[model samples]
Target: MELQKTMQRSLRSEIQKRLKENGYTLSKLSELSGIGTGHLSEMLNSSPSRAITVNQLDAMATAFGHAPGWLYELYPEECLSEGKISRPRLVPYLVRCAEIGRKDCIKAVVSNLLENPKNISILFSVAEQLFQSGKQKESVFFYELVIDNEKDSYSDQFVMSQYRLFRAVQGTNTEENWKAVIRFDSYWKRLPENVQLDALLQLANVCFMMYRWKDVEKYADELRNLATIVYENELLRRTSPKANDLLKTERHLVVYYGQGFLLKAAALKKQRLYEEAKQYIQGYADLGWFEILDETGQQEVEKFRVWAKINSYTLDMMLGNYEILPECITFLEDHPGEIFPALVTIMECANKYGFCIDEVLERFSEYTSYTEDDLNGLSASRHFRFRYQKAIYELQRERFNIGINETLRSLALADKMNHYQDFKQCVSLFEEHRHHASNSQIIAYNKIIEGGTQTNESSVTLVSSSFGIL
Candidate 1:
């Protein structure tokens, strides 16, 4: 009889909790369950006064996973003892809250569970939720707590490494923050080489964000060497029936190799080794390994190609290779809507070599008229550059007011799109042009000053396309 009453209280509490989690008010739930709202209210408020019908209780139980008899046992067990019986049910509710972006709710439930020594899985769930919400610091804290509590769990190492990696990344913009990443890499390297490779890639990204070009190059070289060694070892082994399955599992190795090559190219670009950058980027493009991934990878590879071309054009301009500028322009013309990097390259060439901005603007205008809609679908960075160039063209043609308005509008769009660097550039350009006498003069000056002032802003948060690789 005592057990029966305990079960009733547990069921009632669990039902109420589920309904709240689902955002259903008592009245709403009553309507959905086809029960009188007053009766539902009375039952919930009664505190085990009257026994609920098995059929009605079963309906609620079926939806929330509580037994009918459990709803009747309330008074004697003042507290619902949460043990193995409740932990499983609580996990799904916590997960549901997280899925709906309810971070505070997740925190509340997770905190409650954490206090009860048996709820270890709650820590992992909370860590995952925090990470997804971009709350890396909190994620790491919870993950560390879990690791300290469950030292023998096999997943502890991987979870700890992940937490450390995110912690290091969250502070990457500052030199002091990079130390955490370095520590993470060190810990990861102490693991097996395969595990080390994953950490190495993340470390490379940290180096890139911190603008530690030499470290980026160093890591890329190490990764390449490691990949080559692994490939050779695999080649020397005799094939078994399971070899095909193992080989299939290793397909990610190609992605790792491709990323290493891509990073090496970016490092070269940063060092002003334009030709080297182009060669490496082109090699990755030719390998077509990027195609093995999703659409995001393909877009990223294309963006890298644009970066290579832009740097190549800059190098050519520096070397007085006037012939290359037109070729670059022609290549951009052939690839109509990929205008941002191409525009940057064109501006670099024109600003350095004294190419007529008016002519370039005219060409761009003509190009946009032909492919505006198509180009709109390019990455956000590309879209901003395209609009910026169009605004420049309008300004040059004596459309000062219209040009300012259009440029400001583009800056807002870029901001919404989170193209931080591009948005900053657009803002700077607008501020410069806003003071000009007529819209026509602004347009002329806009062309001449295409590469006007190099703002040291970092790139935007990784777009979905670029994020897949990370």
Candidate 2:
């Protein structure tokens, strides 16, 4: 087959590259591998196909300082996709390929490994190990293998794989999160207590990005209740003082509680329930979670703490406590680009209650690379919201010239992107500020909003995306 010939050529190329890297020649490889000079040359260099066997591959692998199955992974799918290869012989090669970022080889070997349903456990183990190693792309590959294999089953591994896969892909801006969201909502009550806790936390986090504040609050409460149960169970299981290591052992629960507090605060903040949101924030700080966390956890809690405070800053606007808003943004500016979730949260709050945010916008411009076009997927919508709020703040500051310009920019953006509500919102802003604008500019803005004028959509396609009304 043509595929087999291509595989052969790839192997020969790899052998030559490795030989040069290893300072080996044809004679040296033959001497070290105990393969004849003619056969080795043919296998590694010949154009036409010569059969490559496991024994021959093993010999080359031994000589090349690789695992016995390394060479086997270089072959194309035509040679490996069928169940001809034993699972035992294929798993190590596939795992090595996965670890080394050899995605094509992984694809080839998966079919061979997946020929038997019993191999699912081994596959899941590899996926979990890869995930723990922070090789999420490869982990998702193997986790999906398990998902594809399990089909309709609801076994423990299946559920865990589903959870892990969802968590892994949450921020990738794929449509998969919506499916995962639906699944978690339907199955939360039936899940294990710990899984319920994880699912709820994950739902809250994902729904926050989706701008689903009410759902976020609901999931956060469920997450809090589950964390409480786990904490109680941990206490009951241990009597001695050493058992009091709950703080160290149950670190995720600590994060869960912190996250729950912030989400609950945000929801209440959105509803203008500043007093209740403040109560939750004060309750969270009173528990001293800030002291017990590791460096990463400490930083995360502090960021969320600031994030909630920023929301409260807006909620407390009527009470004249909004002055701290600038200080909170300054704190964020000082930290640089460490917690992106905090950035998203800040932008969301700014868009909803943004006032006098010129300083914050300048800070974001100087301190962040988020404005680059490369940020067009997961964080693209957030970036647009950031710009949107900056415009609102301009209007708030009574910078009529800049506000009109921003309104024009926003209107042009909304129309190009087919943002119906945003175009209307921009029109409303223009009407409010029409008294301050020149008649010509106002007419131009109205025409754009009415779809009576042509504007370049590509101009704003990469400018930003995704905003909702305050």
Q: Compare the candidates by lDDT and give the number of the best one.
A: 2
Model 2 per-residue lDDT tens digits across residues 279-370: 77654553343334556666556655555555555455534555666666565556554334344445545555654445555656654344
Q: Which residue runs does candidate 2 get wrong by more than 4 Å?
A: 1-89, 96-108, 172-176, 187-196, 240-251, 289-311, 318-365, 368-382, 395-470
Q: For candidate 1, lDDT tens digit of each residue in 1-470?
A: 99996555554576677888888887777766767777877767785534345355546654454543334222112222434324343444444444445556556555556666666766676566666666544455566667666655445545554544444244212333365565565455455566556556766766665557888888877776776665555555425544532233222655556567767876776677767776766555544443244465465556555545555565566456767766777776766655444564455445456555566666776543322223221233344555676667567666777677668656644554434565577768787777854666466445534633222223213211111111
Q: All candidates' lDDT scores? A: 0.55, 0.61
**Candidate 1, run of 10 with poorest lDDT:** 461-470
User: For residue 159, what is the lDDT in candidate 1?
Assistant: 51
TM-score of predicted structure 1? 0.55
Q: What would you estimate as the lDDT of candidate 2?
A: 0.61
Lowest lDDT block of 10, candidate 2: 461-470
